[model samples]
Target: MMTLEEFKEKNYGKRGNTERDELEAGYENFKIGALIHDTRLEMGMTRHNLQKK
Candidate 1:
């Protein structure tokens, strides 16, 4: 798995284009959200469970 910095460098740095930059940002956000969801699920934690903390 790519670290966020590596992902950004490959997708949004000097070699990147405007369209790709936007898409990469969105993709990054989606990946973060999915990771959070997956982690929570694995821990048997729901939104409400999280909110209680």
Candidate 2:
């Protein structure tokens, strides 16, 4: 089995610094978008309502 560091480097580049940064940034946005999307659904919000907010 590979170590965690090895896996990260293999998938995310050397030490995963660069790719990890990109992944983190994208994930943060994704999380925010998901939260907003879920909240909108719960509130029965339409696209227009979301736009107006």
Candidate 3:
């Protein structure tokens, strides 16, 4: 099986390629969103509650 880095390179191009950069940025955003969602859940907060605050 190919390594994760090898898979990424094969699919998204090299680290410096435009598609790879965009993919990296999108992944970062997804991670941040997941963190926020998890933290909110841990604090017993819903999306509606945050919107009103």
Give the range where candidate 2 is weakest over 10 consecutive residues by summed lDDT: 7-16
Cand. 3 Cα-lDDT:
0.94
Give the Cα lDDT of each candidate: 0.82, 0.84, 0.94
Candidate 2: deviation at residue 3, Å? 10
Off by over 4 Å in 3: none
After superposing candidate 1, which stretches have Cα over 4 Å from the reference?
Answer: 1-15
lDDT (10s digit) by residue, model 3, range 1-53: 99988999999999999999999999999999999899989989999986787
Best-performing candidate as measured by lDDT: 3
Alpha-carbon deviation at 8 in model 1, angstroms: 15
lDDT of 1: 0.82
TM-score order of candidates, best first? 3, 2, 1
lDDT for position 34 in model 2: 95
Alpha carbon deviation, residue 40, candidate 3 (Å):
0.5
TM-score each candidate.
0.62, 0.70, 0.90
Compose the digit string of candidate 2's lDDT tens values, residues 1-53. 99976876778877348877787689799999999899999999997998998
User: For model 1, what is the error of residue 51's alpha carbon versus the real structure, in angstroms, after optimal superposition?
Assistant: 2.6
Error of 3 at 23 (Å): 0.4
- TM-score (C-alpha) between model 3 and the true structure: 0.90
